[model samples]
Target: MNIQDKLSPTAKEIPPSGIRKFFDLVVATEGVISLGVGEPDFITPWHIRESSIHSLEKGITSYTSNAGLLELREEISKYLETGFSLKYSPQNELMVTVGASEAIDIALRALVSSGDEVLVVEPAYVSYSPCVILAGGTPVSVPTFQKDDFKLMPDALESKITAKTKAIIMCFPNNPTGAIMEKEDLEKIAKIIDKHDLIVISDEVYAELTYGKRHVSIASLPGMKDRTINIGGLSKSFAMTGWRIGYVAAHPEIIGAMLKIHQYTILCAPIMGQVAALEAMKNGHNEMKKMIEQYDQRRRLIVKGFQEMGLSCHTPKGAFYAFPSIQATGYDDHVFAEELLKETKVAVVPGSVFGEGGKGFIRCSYATSYSKISEALERIEKFVTPRLNGTCDKVI
Candidate 1:
């Protein structure tokens, strides 16, 4: 009769995300300059927002097809072709979901059975492990080195594979670390996947945000189109997080299975979001380019700031985050982040929140204004440098 007793065992077994806990602490404090959350500082483009309003004015408030509106899918198809040289048939290969988050969950659920093993590269986004576990699969964490720029190595992946391995979850232009896999690296991975007949869930939500080079999809590689599920969304690229629209493209059979699960579990993604996303695909490229350029400037500033502060940060090739090592401070990520917040009132997520290979590091999101980033760096320098001189007992 107890409410707690009635909870599912999986719910009880999973621990709260370390990242969310830090976010809660950051939110409670005033005057805190947070480089913690990984979201764009820009508002959704006016044209994109206006498109949603236009749809509402037309009284288009109804559930879209479970697969999504054909118009939106067509736009997505064209966008993919134009941007990535990827070809996906709008009719059978795509299924719109609430966000890339839902696409990840559905793909894991649809493809994995009990005892299946899911290969995850760390330090990854925190969502992947729990989703795999919830789908009755064991998550096998593969540690990637900062020395390697956190790129997923084919050898590391091959070492983790076993007969029970069902899929490899690829998050490039990655979160937390911001490492991106180049085309040659992806070709190597594709060879391994083909050799093992593995399915790949390519999470490319940050594809449009890369700085040094264009984002390459493993799905676009030779022999990979059929085995790869391309997961992308408007949230990161178009700054439409609140809209909750994302999707996946794959072979019809794979998409069909995902569609069935999505229909029963989610019914449809937000209708307005689909309409907004359609607008973005049709006319939002210029807006995305401007934002990406701004982010690139911010990225360079943050990386430079960290290096000047005596912390070694891997110059992230993509995404909006900088993962800087805190080892020189003689503190773990959790301790370093807490002390930094308490002393400098600058909040950042501890890298350990992203799992193994993330210890002694912290993730600083550059999705804020340049002035804020500068001010935060000043505070960080004042708080951390003196500690090294033994002038302060701690960062505080």
Candidate 2:
């Protein structure tokens, strides 16, 4: 049997995520402190967890409506309206998915036809390119620079557009980089999108984790709601990754199309997750506030620690990751990450794993306890200082 022939070309061609490979290595080793994966260490809030248990106790364990439990969607609608100032009808404009992962996949599958191009700003979340490719769309990576604080510039986006360009995946409060697109920046992208009439798959999964400012959805911009599919989840903001609940709010037509694919593929998001998400919508704001405050303090400490060690770090405005430049260490990102794990026993992801413009940086997630971060910092300083001073021949 020709197994290779049976595999889809896209599946065969897509490389494994670089971040996961290093993570596998680190996880297998003893005594390695990981800041590699972008996940909050906190447990899902007690009330949300209790809601799921309550649902199960009530025998509400069956499959939900294809579009999700209507009640959950209604709660989500109200939550989005209250939190992000975005409004949409729960009945027609929303669909719950297994997670933001599925929301991303469904949106791309619905909007992108064969050979259509979807622009992704790099260093992006790992899933965007593969999701676009799997949908038979070409992933056009627009490299955003550190000097620009990784913001997506309108001119850069405009230059990448072609007749085949169908959509743009906007990842703000971004993973690995922690850069959030401010309102003015979002307005610039909105202007470009308006000119091209391009659809937007806005991933706002990290919206609630912003440091000092409120997260502004691109969908909130003028003329954007109709063209934007807002993707969000309970994963980052509410520490609900294992709960596996996510949703999309878009124009009814787009939501309908995504719902069709989701119906056939996923049927419904987990019943328990839906119940939990509904509870989260009702009572998670205060929890989000507390977690954000903790993350803000850790965000500052980690950024400061990296700077104090003479590594230049982008002071992240959102998310709990710090992307620090490794150029001063005289090692490429992969080499630095590998050596750091082996020598210091502290694991972080190489930025290049995210995409271009990440070659000389590494992403350190500050989602763990402050003590863990402090220990990691100590090991990092010991490992890096000698390397920078030329006392160490090589990192490993």
Best by lDDT: 1
Candidate 1, residues 7-120, lDDT tens digits: the string is 999989988987788789988998999999888899999999999999999999999899999999998998899899899999999889999999999999999999999999
TM-score of each: 0.98, 0.97
lDDT per residue for candidate 2 within 239-279, as digits (tens), equals: 99888899999999999999899988989998999999988
**Backbone clashes (count) for model 1:** 0
Give candidate 2 misplaced runs (Cα > 4 Å).
none
Off by over 4 Å in 1: 394-396
Per-candidate alpha-carbon RMSD to the true structure: 1.4, 1.3
On the 0 to 100 scale, the lDDT of residue 152 in model 2 is: 89
Worst 10 contiguous positions by lDDT, candidate 2: 387-396
